[model samples]
Structure formats: structure tokens, C-alpha cells
Target chain A: MPREDVEDLELELLLEALYRHYGYDFREYARASIKRRMWRRMMEEGLATLSGLQERVLHDPACMERLLLDLSINVTSMFRDPTFYRAVRDKIVPLLRTYPFIRIWNPGCSTGEETYSLAILLREEGLESRARIYATDINAAVLQQAKEGIFPLDRMQEFTHNYLRYGGRCSFSDYYKVYGDRARFDPSLLEHAVFAQHNLVSDASFNEFNLIVCRNVMIYFDRALQDKVHDLFYRSLVRSGVLALGHKESIRFTSHADAYEELDRQEKLYRRVL
Target chain B: MVVGGSWGGLDALGQLVALLEEGCSLALAVALHRAADSPEGAMVSYLQSRCPLPVAEAEDKDAIQPGRVYLAPADYHLLVEPGRFALSIDAPVHHSRPSIDVLFETAADAYEEASGAVILTGANDDGCRGIRHMKRRGGVTMVQDPCTAVRREMPDAAIATGAVDKVLPLDQIAAVLNGLGRA
Candidate 1:
């Protein structure tokens, strides 16, 4: 047998162990990405192989926590794609205003950058008082960061630029107060926001929402998992509810594709017509 | 698979495509750095017209077929997983979303010794680490010669890794790829 095949088997075993022991099912993640991350963890720990890394992780809970952080992609920024925000402001916000009350679910909201962006957008559009933003992620550590409402100060410039491009009304600096290397965002932005730990894979939907924004998260999952999440989102949304995905993600190949109408295809915004 | 980046990539890719024989069976995947907001399907249309082989943007979970060329969509990292191709919006690597290294590394893992990786015309050092992974996985690695490249930084970086097996000019790359397909 080849060494690569051996490593592959070891990886599968590790994922199974992670599922059985920790209730974290990464078994359906894109294999190549998982392997790359696992190998990186192995190198970081000075382990020679995936099996060695798995052994250490199984024995040490701290190691497992570190592994979880590695597996959960935390790459996000405030208004990362300004154009998507622009579309939400121009198209989605108007429809959202029609409702007397709004519930927005941001599943897989890593560190809550986009969630905060949405909150600010709602506040500017006079819908913050009537909106409830539920921000959830599989990782609790990132949830804690989201609740803190603080971000790196260096990123403020870029975030401000994105904010302006996305039709921000007030001075971007009004949203956050910088203290040295970190900026503490205004807590009022999250006044109606709820930060909680919710696993999209294993957990069931808790509430019906008017809008579901899950961007860039499903791309990490395999087809079956993607379909499962789509079903969950479909069920969680009210009729005519809006579903916004990352610019690259689409509902085209999913089972529920035909149920939704494209509100803005380029921005991946869809309305649940069925 | 063949990969290229920034400088001189358009011209080099055209030359490389022109050199290929009419019906090579090996499937090719190209990852190029593109702005996140670029018009969809533009690159695929442009490349399709220049190459004889059918060219298209790789869709998520699509089966990888032979005798076709797949271009990575902007803002997504193209990944090869067994018999199918997967797309990811996972954060950028080397500051590139459609990173050449991500594609090359995944291809190396999927095809192993049967894989062939090419690094060409780019201003950044994105594909260097990926080519090293390819060689370590017993795959063939090639880079466009720096002197012939519009920008030398990328090819030079790949060559600096010492994992490259060939450093061919743009005109010679397609013939080498054709030879590999036949082999």
C-alpha cells in the first residue's frame, strides 16, 4: 500500500474518532482541505503522521480544542465583500422593512463580522428596533469574540472603506472607538443581537426567520452536508423569506433550488417563493 | 494540471494552448488570481475561444472528466477530491482566493505520482509551496523559465524550491503536457 493511502485511512479514522468521542462530525468536510489542515496540525505538533496527531488529540482535550480551532475556518472580515452588503442595503433591506418585526439568522457566523455588518445596516435603515439578529457558530470560542464587539484596529481602515462602498451613512469611526491596537465596536450595534453556539450539522432549527445569511460556510462541506444545510435553511425560513449566500455559493444544484427565486443572482440572494 | 498567475499569463497561456495537439486526454485545471468582483464566466469564455480543448468553470461537486480544461472561479479555491472537483470560499492563501497553491496541492493529493503541476508567469510566490508538495508526493513539477516570463518572481520562486523537474518556455510547455498525456 502507498504511504498516501495509509495517511488517507488514518485521516478517516481520526475524523471518526473525533465524531464518536467529541460529537464533532467533520467526516463530511472536503477531504483535501481537511487533510491539508490535519497535516499542518501534525507539523505544528512535531508529529510525523496523521495517526500520531490523532493519538495525541484523543488523549489531550486541549489538543482536541486546538484541532477544532484549526478545522473551523475563522476567516472573515467586516463588510468583506462590499458589493454583497450593497445589494442587501439596496434590495433586501426594503423588503425587510415591510415586516413589522424581522428575525435574521446568521448560521455559521464565524466571529460575527457579517452579523455586525447586518446589524449596522439595519440600524441605519431604521429597522434595528424591530430586528432580532441571531448569530450562531459551531465554535464557542469565536462566539465569545463576537460578543466582545472588538476587532483589530489595523483592519478598521479596510472595514471603513468597505462600509463607505456599501453605502454607509455615518462616519465609520462613529461605530467603533479605537484603543491602541484594537477597536471596541459600539455595543449598541448588537443590542438586539443574540450570540450563541449552534451546530448546523447536528442541531435542528430553533426559530423561523425572515432572512437567512450563511455565507462562505457551506463551501467547506461536501455535497450531502450542503444539501442537509439547505434543507434546514429552507425549513427555517418563512414563505418569501430571503436567503443570502456568499458570492460564490449558489442554490442551483441543491434539491431546493427550484423552490427559490433569484432576487440577485450575482450576489447569491434568493427569495423563498415556494 | 497547468497553472499560471499575474504577469504575462495571458500571452503565455495562449502560447501554451496553441502548442497542444488536437485531442489530448489529460484533464487540465488552471487557477489564476482574479478580482473577487470580476464578471462571472468571463475567463472561461476567453480561454475556451483560445484553446481547442473544451474549457469551462469548475462547478462545486462536479465530476472531473478527461479532455477538458477547468478554470477556477473567482473568489473560490478549486479543490480536487477523488473523482470530483470541490470549490471552497475558505480564506485566501498567500493573499489569493483562487490560489494556485491550493489547486496544485489538492491535485497532488488526488492524483499523486500521476499528477503533473506547472507554474507559470506570475508576480507573486503563490505556487512555490504547492509545487514542492507535488514533488514530495512523487508528481512531476514544471515552471516557466524566468527569462521567458513577463514577471520572474513566481517562476523564480517555484524554481527556488528546487522541486521543479522542468523549466520550459511557454512554447514548449504544451508539448511536454501532450507528451505526459500520451504517456
Candidate 2:
């Protein structure tokens, strides 16, 4: 067999070990991205091959945690795409207002940027008191960070720009207090927020939600995994519940495609119609 | 796959498209650096007019079809997985989210020796490492000659890597691509 084939076999075994031992199912992730992340983890650990890293991770829980962090993409920003937030305020807020209470689920909420952004949006619209936002991620480490709500102070400039572009009604700085290198966000924003670890690959939907914002998370999943999550989302959403994905993500190709109607095609906002 | 960057990329791509024959068999993926929020469907409409092949922005898990050209959508890295395309919103590489390097490197791994990468007019060095990866993986690597490029930094950087298989003008790149399709 070729060297590349041998490496592939090793990678498969590694993923299998990870799933069987750690209950993290990365087997269905897009292979190219997984392969790149695996190689990167190997380099970081100073190991020569995927099998070596796998052995370390399986035996040591710390190693597994480190590897999990590496595999889980934590790239995010506050109101990363301003237009999507604008659509939420312009199009979805009115519908959310009609309800007595709002339950919003933000799966794979890396470091709580989107969660806080939503909290701010709801507060600005005077709906925060009636909203309960559940911010979940597979990685506990990131969930901890999300609960803290502290970000690099330097990133505030970019976040402020995004906030303004998203039609923020107040000064962006009003939400957070900067100290040296870190900026601590206002705790009032998270009063109704619940931060928890929820693995999309393994966990079932716990409750029906009025809105589910899982932007950019599905892009990492393969077709089968994507279908599975879409099913979960379909079951979890209340009638006419809103689902907002990343700018590039869509429901057109999923099994639940027909169940939701496109609310904003450009912003990837969909509403449960059936 | 042909990856171009800033400067005269649009014009060069138009020229290359005009020169290629209809119904080319090779599946083409183009990564051109654009604003993350640029209007979708704009590139498809612009390029479809000049090219005979079907042109569209790549969507997640879309199967790679021959005789078609797929453009990397803005703000997402287009990765070539086995038999399908995957998009990533991971941090931008070399300040580009739809980085030419990400697409080319993934293509090199997915297609191996069967792949051909073309680096065209650009002001950045994003495609240099990707072309090198392609060449190391036994895939064909070509660069637009720096003299003919509107901005020489990109082609010059690829050439500096010493992994480029051909250095041709924009007009001739289509011919080489057609020959690769035949092969």
C-alpha cells in the first residue's frame, strides 16, 4: 500500500479511538479539514504520526482535551457578519415580540460572541427580560470562556465596528468594561443566559426553541452528520421558529429543506413553516 | 484549478475563459480574493458570459462536476474533499478567507498527481505555498509570467519557490489548461 493510504488508515483508527473512548464523533467531519487539524495536532505534540497522537490522547485525558480543543474550530467574532444581525433585528424581532417568552438556542457558540451579541440585540429591543438564551458547545473549555464573557480588549475595535454596522442603538463600549488587555462584558446581558456543553453529534434536543442560531457549525459536518443535525433542529424548533445559519450555510440540500421557508436568503435565515 | 489574486485578476480570468474551448473536461475551481460581504451570484453572472462551461459559486458538499467551473464563495475557504467541495469559515490565511492557498493545497491532496494548479496575477504571496504543495505532491503547477502580470508579487513569489512547472502569459494559460483536460 502507498504511504498516503497508510496515513489515511491511521487517521481512521485515530478517529475511531476518539469516538469509542471519548464519545466525540469526528468520523463524519469533512476529511480534508480533519486531516489538516490532525496533522496540526501531531506537529504541536511533536509526534511524527497520527497513531502516536492517538495513543497519547487515548491514555491521557489531558491530551484528549488538548486534542479536542485543536479539532474544534473556535474562530468567531461578536456580530461576525453585521448583515445577519441586522436581519435578525429588522425581520425576526417583530415575530419574537409576539411571543410571551423566547427560548433561543445557539449551538456551537464558541466563546459566547454570538450569544452575547443576541443578548445585546434582545436588550436593545427590550426583550431580554422575556428571553432565555442557551449557549452550548461541545468543548467545555470554550463553554467556560463563553460563560466568562471576557474578550481581548484589542478585538473591541472590530466588534464595535460590527455592532455599529448591525445597527446597534448605543455606544458599543457601553456593553463591556476594558481593563488592560481584556474587556469584561456586562453581566446583566447574561442574566437569562445558560452556558452548557452540548455535543451536536451525540446529544439529543432537550427543549423546543423559538430561535436556533447555529451559524458556521454545520460546514464542518459531512452530509450525513448535517442531515442528522437538521433533523434535530427540525424537532427542536417550535412552529414558525427561526433558524439562522452562517452566511454560506443553507437548508436547501438538507432533508429538512422543505420544512422551512427562507426568511432572508442572503442572511441564511429560515423559518419553520410546517 | 486556477487561483488568482488582486490587481488584474478579473481581466486575466476573463481572457483565460474566452480562450478555452467549450465543454472542457477538467473541473475548475477558482479562488479570487474579494470582500467577504460581496454580493453572491455576481461572479457567476460575470464569468458565465465569457465561459462556455457552467459557472457557479461553490456550496457545501456540492459534488465536483467536470466541465464546470466553481468559484469559492466570499468569506469561506473552499476545500476539496473526496468527490465533493467543503467550505470553512476558519480564520483567514494570508489575510484571505477564500484563500487561494487553502483551495489549492486541499486540491493537491484530494487529486494528487491528477491535479493542475495555475497561479495568476496578484499582489500577494498567498498562492506560493499552495503551488509548492501541489508540485511536491506531483501535481502540475503553473504561474503567470511576472512581466505580463499586472502585479508581479504573486507570480514572482511562486517562481521564487522553484516549484512552478510553467511560467506562461495569461493568453497561453487556457491552452495549457485545455491540454491538461485532454491528458
Candidate 3:
């Protein structure tokens, strides 16, 4: 038998074992992505085989933690697409202005780039004072990084460029203090932000929000999982609240498409109409 | 040719595969970064339905052909010889077995000047080095414009290497491949 076929079966067995042994539900995620991540790590760590890696994961808590981090793709940058931020500033912020108090969800908020970016944007728009921002991810390593709010100083140039392109009204540097070789964002920006662990694949909705931005995160999920997260987003949104997706993700074919109208098609912004 | 990607890569691969014109003279194999649980055959089936070329799940030691798209089945590293596909129990590269780099490197050694490599939308820097190797060995290099990519990291990394010969939008990539087919 081909080793890949056997590895595929082993991966299925590993997923099952993980759920039975650890209660982390990843059975529904897109399989190929998962396999690639695991296989990539296996090569990096010098494991002899998939089963060998599985044995290590089953026995070692630290190993499993590392595996979880590897499985979660947390590549993100501040103000990733400036135009998307501008759309939020113009279209979503106005509606947020009407609500006396608001909650916003940033699901799969890797390394807190989008979380902090949203917080900074809301603070500038005078909405953070009355808003509660919940940023959740399955990766604890990235969450720790997010909480630090310390980014490489080398990235400042690019961040500044993206900020300007996204329609920043103030100097992008105004929001953060540059320390030695690192830029530490103002802690004040995070005053209303809550960083926590929430798995979109397994966690239940804990709070409803006036706006939910789950950008660039859902493409890793299979159609069923995407639909599940869409249901979670639909359940978590207040009627007439807004939803923002990454440039590629859409609710068009999902169950939630009817629940939201495309507010800005180019930016993938939507508002719950039903 | 070997292909690899994750996140926003599915549509990108579909377009790339569909662009392979009928009766073209090159054996193409793709290692799509996909989940082990998702149906691999469906993507091949989907591409087969659209393109005039044959598309299917790659089998071990399958003959490489022009005008064909062979997907690296989930969880395996797909390697290539001059005219055949090989599977490896060898470790994954950059955390992926059917790694784009592994395929590109091998194909670079084999196909050299005749090779054509494309890196599309993905969240990680998986294809950068692969595209570099392809170009180093005189293979044609094409990258999706990161600005328009759904997940720009892969193509962005390739462009950052200064190895990409052409960077086009996703919609325009098929035409380029079609043109190459005609040429």
C-alpha cells in the first residue's frame, strides 16, 4: 500500500484519538490542510513517520501544544487590506455609532493583528470607549503574542504604509510606542479588548455582537465547518448588525447569505438583514 | 509539475488546471495543500469536467503527460521523474509532504528549461523557494499578484524572491497558460 494512503488513515486515527483523549474537535476541518501541517511538522521535527509523531503527541502535553500551534495558521498583519478597513470606518462605524453599547467578535484573530487593528481603529473613531472587543483563537502561542502587542520594528514601515492606504486619519505611529527594536502598541488601545481561547470548530457562542469580523480564517475550514461557523456568526449577530469577511470568504452559498445583505461587495462587508 | 497550497488555494488551482489546453504536450502534477479528510477526487473531477485535458487523482509511478493534471493525493509527497510520478515516504517540506518545494526541486532537476511553475494564493510562504528553484533551473515562473490574491503570502513570497517572470491577477492567469499552450 502507498505510504500516503496509510498516512491518511493514520491521520484519521490521530484525529479520532485526539478527540477521545483530548476533546479537541478538529474532525471537521479541511483534511488536506491538516495533513499538510502535520506532515510539515513531522519533517521539521525529524520524526520518522506520522505514527511516530502521533505517539509523541499522545504522550506529551508540550508536544500536543506545539502541534496545535503548528496546525493553526496564524499569518496576519496589521490593517492587512487597507481598503477593507476604510469600508469598516465608513460603513460599519456609523451603525456602531448608533448603538449605545456594542460588542464585536474577531474570530481566528491570529497574533491579534486584526484584533488590535480593529481596536485602534475603533478608538480613533470614538467607538472603543463604549465597545467591547472579543478576540478569540485556538492557538495559545499566537494569543500570547497578541497580548504582548509587540511587533517587530522592521514591520513598522509596511504597517505604516498599510495604515495610510487604509485611510488613517492620524499618524499610524500615534497608536504605538517604539521601544528598542520593537513597537509596543498603547495598552490603552486594549482596555476594552478581551483576548481569549475560542475554537470556531468546537466552542459554543458565548456572546452576541453588533459586528463580527472573521477575516482570512475560514478558508482553512471545509464547507461543513464553514457552514457551522457561519451559523455561529449568524447566531452571534444582532439583527441589523454587520459582518466582515476576508477578501475571499463569502456567505453567498452558506446558510447565512440570506441572513445578511452584501453591504460592500468589494470589501466583503455585510449587514444582517434578517 | 508539482503544485502546493492551503487556505485560499482551491479556486486558484482550479483555474490553473482548467487552463491546461487539450492535446498540450506536458505532464502536470499538482500537490495541493489540502486536508486529509476532504475529498481529493472531487477536485480532480471538477477540473476534469472543465478542461479539455484529462485530470485525475495521481497514482504511484503514473506516467507524466502533457495536457493532464494529476493531483497529489492527500497526505503524500508527490515527486516527479522525467516522465513519471513517484511517491515518497520521505518527510514533508515546510510542514507539507506534497510540498511545492519538493516537487519543484525535483522537476527543476528533471524538466529544466521545459518546465513551467505557477504559485497561487496561500497563507504561508510555501512556494517561494520552489518558484526560486524552478527559475534557477530555467523553468518558467508565474505568480499570482499578491495584491489581488485572496491569501497573498505564497505568491508574495515568490515575488519577493525576484524570481517570478510574470505576476498576473487570478482571472488573467488562465489566459497566460493558454497562450503558453498555443506557443
Candidate 4:
């Protein structure tokens, strides 16, 4: 067989080992990004091939954890897409306020930047007192970091700029206090929030929610996996509940296209009308 | 097939995209750096207005179609798999979301020798490594002649690697694309 095919076979075996041993089913993740991350882990460990990297990861739990971090991409920032948040503030927040008690599920909430963004939005709109946010991810490490409410100080400038554009009412600096090179965000923002580990690939929905904010996460899953998760989200949402995805994602291609009506197509917010 | 451009890329890419006739019998994946908030549908509308082919902003897990142009959506990396396109929110490469390197490299891995990639006018060298990898995988590779490019650094960088199979001007590059290998 050709060398590239051999490399592909090695990656498949490694993914199998990762699943069989760790209960982490990355087999359905987008192949391009997953392969790139595996290659990065291999190079960082000074291994020349995927097979060698697989051996090390299978034997060392710590090595697997490192690979896990690489696999679960954390390329996020607070209110990264300011316009999306602006739309949420202008359109979705009013709907959220109607509920006597709001329940939001933020799956794949890596490191919780957007979750905190949502929390702050709630507090500003006077809905924080009755809102319950369940911020969950497949990786416990990110959840731990999310609970800490700290972020890199360098990213603050960009976050601040985004906050201003998203119509933040107060000074962006009011939320966090600096500690050395990092900024520890106000823990009170998460006062009604709960952080936990929940794998979207394997776990069942534990509770119905009034809103679901799963942005940029499904882009990493294959179509079949994306459909499965969308079904989960559909079932997890209450009647006329809101679902917000990343700007680029759409439900039109999936089986659930008719199951919901468009709330704001440009902003990728949908309302379940069926 | 895959094509990449940046900085003065709108005209360069639009010209190339316009060359993909309705019966071109080839799929084209394109990447160009664009702002996260580039006024929804404006870019696709502009590109579509210039070309006879159907122009689209790529979505995750989209099936690759022949005689169509797929533009990398803003703030996402467009990657190709066997017969489908995948999107990623992975960190930008070369400070560029929708990095040409990410698109071309994945295209090379997915299609191997069946792939054909063109590196056009760009300010940065994002497509160099990807085009190099394509050439090594026996895929056809080409670069727009630096002198003919609005931004020469990108094509010059690819030429410096000695992996480009051909270096041509804009008109000739479009001609070569018109005469695609039908991969």
C-alpha cells in the first residue's frame, strides 16, 4: 500500500484504541482537524509516526490527556463574534425573559468564555436571578478552568472591544480583576451556573432547556454525528424554545429543517415551532 | 480542485472563478481571508454575480459538487475529505482564518494524485506548505507568476520551495483551469 494509506490506517487504529480504552468516541469527529491534531501531538512528542504516538498515549494516561486537549479545540474568546451576541441580546434575550424560570444548556462550552458572556447578558437584562445555566463539555479540564472564571489578560483587550460592540452597558473591566498575567473574572457571574462533564457523543440529555447555545462545536463533527446531536438538541428543548448555533451552521441541511422555524437566520437562531 | 488567494484576491479569485464554465466538470474549493462580520451574503452574492457557476459559502460536511465554486466561509477553515467538505474552528493559520494552507493541505491528503491546486495572488505564504505537500503527493500544482500578481510574496514563496509544477500569468492560469483534468 502507499505510504499515505498506511498513515491513515495507523490513525484509524489509534482512534479505535482511544475509544476502546478511554470511552472517548472521537471516531465521528471531522477527520481533517482530528488528523491534524494527532500529527501535532506526534511531532510534539518527537515521534516520527502515528503508530509510535499511539503506543505512548495508550500506555500513559497523561499523554492521552494531552492529546485530548489538542483534540478538543479551545480556540475561543469572550463574545468572539460580537454580532452574534448582539443579535442574541436584541432578539433572544426578550424571549428568555418571558419564562418564569429560564434553563439554558451550553454544550461544548470549552473554557466557558461564551458561557460567561451569556451570564453577563442575563445579569444585564435582569434575568440572571431566575436563570439556570448548565455549562457542560466532554472535557473535565476545561470545565475546571471555566469554574475558576479566569482568562488570559492579553485576550482582555480583544474581549473588551467585542463587549463594547455587543452593547455591554458597563465597563468591561468591571467584570474581572487582574492577577499577574491572567484576569480572574467575577465568580458572581456564574452564581446560577453549574459546570459539569457531559459527552455529547455518548451521553443522553438529562434535562429539557429553554435555550441551547451550541456554537462552532458541531462544525467539528461529521454529518451523521451532527444529525444525532441536533436530534438530541431538538428533544432537549421545550416547545418554541430557542436554539442558537454558530454563524456558519444551519439546520437546513439536516433532517430537522422543518422541525423548527427561523428566528434569525442570519444570526443562526431558531425557534422550535413543531 | 483547490484554489487560494489573498490581499488583492477578490479580483484574482473572481477572474479564476469566472473561468469555471457550467460544464467545467470539476469542483473548486477556494479560500480567501475575510472579516468575521463581512456583511452576510455580500461576498457570495458578489462572487456569484461574476460567475456562471453556482457560488456558495461552504457548510460543514457538505458534499463536493462538480461545476460549482465553494468559498471558505468567514472565521472557519475549509478542509476536504474523500468526497465531502469539512469545516473547523481550529485556530487560524498564518493569522488567517480560512487559511489557504489548511484547505490545500487537506485537499491533497483527501484526493492525493487526483487533486489539482493553484496558488494565486496572495500577500502571505499560507499556500506554500500546502502546495508543496500536494506536489509531493503527485497532485498537479501551479503558482501565478509573481510579476503578474498584485501581491508577490505568496507565489514567490511557493516558487522558492521549487514544488510548483508551473508558473504562469493570470490569463494562462485561467486557461489551465478551463482545461481541467476532470478530477
**Predicted structure with the largest TM-score when compared to the true one:** 4
Which residue pairs show backbone clashes in model 4? none
Residue clash pairs of candidate 1: none
Q: Predict model 2's lDDT versus the native.
A: 0.88
Chain A only: list TM-scores of all candidates. 0.98, 0.98, 0.96, 0.98
lDDT of 2 by residue, B53-92 (tens): 8888888888999888899988888999879999887778
- In the range B1-183, model 4's lDDT, one tens digit per residue, is 898998888888877777666677778899988776566678889889888888898877889988888999887899999999988888889899888989999999999988988888888889989989999899999998999889999999989989999999877887787787343
lDDT of 2 by residue, A58-124 (tens): 8899988888887665567898889899999999999999999999999999788899999999999
Docking class of 3: incorrect
lDDT per residue as tens, model 1, B39-121? 67777777777888888888777788888888888778899988888887667898898889889989999988888898888
Please provide, for model 1 over A18-84, each residue's C-alpha lDDT reduced to its tens digit, 9 standing for 90 to 100. Answer: 9998999999987887887888789999999889988999899999888887876556778877888
Q: Each prediction's Cα RMSD? A: 2.3, 1.7, 11.5, 1.6
Best by DockQ: 4
Stretches of candidate 3 exceeding 4 Å from the true structure: B1-183
Tens digit per residue, CA lDDT, model 4, A1-274: 9999999899999999999999899898888889988998999999999999989998999999889888765687898788889898898888888899999999999889989999998998899999999999998888898999888899999899889988899899999999999999999999999998999999999998999999999988888899999999999999999999987788988888898999887789999998
Cα error, candidate 3, residue A79 (Å): 0.2
Candidate 2 clash pair list: none
What DockQ does predicted model 4 obtain? 0.70
Error of 1 at A82 (Å): 1.9
Error of 4 at B75 (Å): 1.4
TM-score for each prediction?
0.93, 0.95, 0.67, 0.96
